[model samples]
Target chain A: MSTKTDKIDRLAELTAQQESSSGASLWREALKRLRASKMALVGAWIIAVFLLLAIIGPWVAPYAPGQQWRGEVFVNRAEFVGARAENWFGLDHLGRDIFSRMLVGARQTLLLGVVSTLIGLSVGALIGSFSGACATLGGRVGQRIDSVVMRCIDIMLALPSLLLAVSVAAVLGQSMTTVMIAIGVVQIPVFARLLRGAMLVQGGSDYVLAAHSLGIRKRRIVLTQIMPNSLSPVIVQATLSLATAIIEAAALSFLGLGNPDSAKNPEWGVMLTQAQNYADSAPMMAVYPALAIIITALGFTLLGEAMREALDPKLRG
Target chain B: MSLLELDDVKVHFPVKKGLIFDRTVGHVYAVDGVSLSVEEGQTYGLVGESGCGKTTLGRSVLRLVDITDGSVNFDGTDLAKLPAEEMRTFRRRLQMVFQDPLGSLNPRQNIESILSEGMAAHGIGGTREERREKIRDILAKVGLPANALARYPHEFSGGQRQRIGIARALVLEPDVIICDEPVSALDVSIQAQVINLLEELQESLGLTYLVIAHDLAVVRHISDVIGVMYLGSLVEEAPSDALYAEPRHPYTKALMSAVPVPDPEVEDRRERILLTGDLPSPANPPAGCRFHTRCPWAQDTLCATERPALKDVGGGHKVACHFAAEIAAGTVERTAASVVPATREEMADRVVETPAE
Candidate 1:
């Protein structure tokens, strides 16, 4: 008994030695790869700066987002003509500080992007998993269900995304909620197709077969064994979709389909529409909001691409 | 009563054709009419070449694949007739260890969850603590340390992973285990270690196993009863010692001759019967004796027109052939019907000739 205990003790020591040497899990391995890449770091920093700006941009602004200051400053046309030290981004057609509105617009654009992307992701993932699960668990019935679900997705995918969003927003009436819903609805087919493809590949893997042989419930096997392995590509696609969502939402608002009270609230898309009249006189008003959208979208795209490279098992050692 | 009985079981996968609307044109007879049994504490080894449907036969008993016909009796219950829920209940008594050890385990799950999955599924342990204790005990029994429970499958070596696979099957205290080439993927030394561990475990736990492999030496070493499968059908079934000493069926004789002997003197004098062609498409097997297409001693008349049933010549040994006694007594001579082995180009032409459609 003493020798047996001692043998186990020795084996335990060897096991601990091996564990400490190879402690990284899949997520940790992906993180290590992400940290090693220079472009991914730049992307991370850009996203962080934008997120911080969105959260506190209103508090740090020199003036209110919609404060009109025509007569208060230069009493005449000079307020609209040149830049002032007080207003770093100069004045718009309404003589409002472009810098303040730009800051607040960051918040509005980001809120739209995050909310719509979440809706798209959750709804798309649910639909994809349902179709994927049916195809995996139902056997003959699953093949029929798969064809039906995929055909619906194909029909949605056939329509131009912006056109679909436009029609949906037109039907729902102009509001922030409608813009979010429109963008999210447009995004559904993309996520659904991607996740369904991933799930199909994972469903045929040997581990899923092993799980089935163990007499695990089909539902449990689909959820626990197949779902987790199928998530990496879906997650990477979600980030990329955020960039698309932001652009789609902004396009809807630019077409006079955003919140009706945009002149008071001052979102980036509404701000762009308001800046169109003074494109020559005060080009800074148009440039600032456009730059914000472009930079924010680029940040998400870069990060998503970097994540795809990092999480790819083939790319790893 | 036998611990498990497979009575004339058959599993045929439909071969569908056409791009738009797939219609079944033919069936791949993967496991065609196989009947065998495993006693309570005996090990049954099934030996066959690759694609001969040995794995399909093993999986049919566990109901991993739906049987097209016949019954699988497990502990006096017909598993083929059992409802899905009732069959799930019986899964605790029958488990499988897969061919690819690493591929068989979920990469995301820790060892504790993998080992305790069957237990938790069947409500074996009362609480988390009890389950953890059970996992720890099984790990130790499989020659793993206690710390293994916290690690994932990737952290272990191939041999270690196979041990974990066995531990998972053993954790449920199963009555029968269908091990599908459990050690074929490991190093030779590792294979020996795993086989010895299986033997020790069987002695301690009194477990019955249905071990499937392509290696005759490996099967002979571990099996109490051995069955040789040729193209989705059993050719011979006998006690392991008897089967190794005197393999009666021509297919079994060809299989036994192919196993390499370690001693050079004995190896040089041994007769080797090279088969004439690859396995004919299972979707369209020959009309009569399936082995007649390639058998060296195949007669011209009855062997091609009539299918022979497995018959007991004496004792419990069974053989499926037209002239098992003549071949065993060395009275029959090899016929000149054996064709030269087909080349790859010829094989490809054959495949194109009979498309599934």
Candidate 2:
């Protein structure tokens, strides 16, 4: 027992010294844990490479994403001297370079996923805070409000998320913004429930009760005290949701509910739609875009899983 | 004038049952009709067994828990009558130190933020530099180093965490602090250190404290005045030394007997009056004397039918008992039925048998 306490004391002293000198915060501690996970580091590297490729792909591609090539029999190779070398990943039935299309497709896929997930996260967090704050009141009025908000979320959650997104997309018409809105609206309930549950537990903590006794305003307590502490789980959930958002966006595009400029556009789902006819003959056309979607989703999933494990005390050690 | 006064304060929690809509089935009388006053610069120790509602009474004084009925007057202001906005400002004069040292401080926040939270809320200490200096000063007074400010609550031991808890309250410069079992969760040796620190701070700052604890010895050592509570009512109130020397109430005598005497010879020779049966549920306490069901000197007729009001005996010592003098003088004989052990389950069954609320 003495040795155990002694070790604890030593550990505490070391941390205290480190904290005083560097002013270490919770974020810093989380970063330290993130750095320790090799999978998280690899995911971060993949995301960086993907983002760089998406931004500069148009400038660097040998052929324009929309430029198509005719075969040697149809057109002389000498007339289009660089066509054979440039269309390395070959051409679709539309004759667009599959390699260039996949490169440009990354831009649309990532942009839609991030924007929609952020929209979902913000709306869900707002609703969650409202319901969570009401529940903390712990009176008749609070209980009534809490039950109403939670039941509404339950109704949304009852429908399959993809089906809801599909119907929403169908109504809005074929546009990238519409696709984002559809996927974003479908994910609101997941974030709402996670945040609300986290806040409920945090609201009941002794420190929150102590804050009440100190005469801190309810708003300040909910914002400064409860929100920050309750945010880790919601953050982890958001990362995981981003991966799902990307896949959902791709699915919508594949169903012809995506970008209206299907012929000229290089969105992954549009490429897959265009590549279906030649899927058996030149399987690489389908393989390239499908690989791009799979790898991007895998990156986010790995990072999200690592973050969840990092935040979990039982899993950390 | 007394620093704090509770005039028959009561806090009852509604017991709810139902699936679709919750219906109030009954009430748990956590604190029922408790009245006491604490003078300025004095330590008033509240003692009771677990679930006796002493903690609720302390919280009521600070208006942390709303009073269902009655008034809590602090420094000439009726807290119950004050509006929410006014009460919030008035809260600056009062503060609390919770029982669990670790749980009471925000784990995510560093020591500086935790200690400065009250000051930030009340808008005390004008500038950042001023607030930082004030926090440093308070940390020193609480025996923590200035560097401790950057550390989180989890880094500290139970004793250090308590000192930080005290520092948080003291930084606000409040007139009264309600310490709810502040040392109960600490190690035996650390309990004395924390208790002594509280006493020294009280003397230096002239801070009035409502110390709630179940340990009689700790209370006897620190409190100037002591109030003993049972099933949500004050059964005895007196100066600590006088109450310890000559306990008047039958319940007080029984409580005092339970405290083991240090010397083995004296401890063996002392008469231990063991009270039979469990404490009656506050929701449905026995009519008349709440203690009659377990009191050795209880009379058959009046003790069971009429509740005894807290009346003064002598020297400002008040006790709520029909035969306080006879019981204290050892002239009253124990009723045979009162000596039989009644488990808490049996007592709960009796409460269920009682038809009325």
lDDT of 1 by residue, A179-201 (tens): 99999998888888888888899
lDDT of 1 by residue, B106-168 (tens): 887788878777787788999989999988898889999787777788778999999999998
How would you class the docking of model 2?
A: acceptable
Candidate 1 at B111: error in angstroms? 1.0
Task: Give native contacts recovered, as a fraction, per prediction.
Answer: 0.38, 0.50
TM-score of 1: 0.89
Off by over 4 Å in 2: A1-21, A69-95, A137-143, A270-288, A312-317, B18-21, B266-280, B292-299, B336-357
Q: Candidate 1: which docking quality band? A: acceptable
Instruction: Return the top candidate by DockQ.
Output: 2
Chain A TM-score of model 1 comes to 0.89
lDDT string for model 2 (B1-357, tens) is 787988999999888899878899998899988889999999999999888899988888777778899999899999988887788888888988999998888868888888787899899999888999999999899898888887888778999999999998998899999999999999999999999999999989999999999999999999999999999999999999999999998888889988988987676556777888899998888899888888878888789999888898989899999988887777888774434345445667899989865
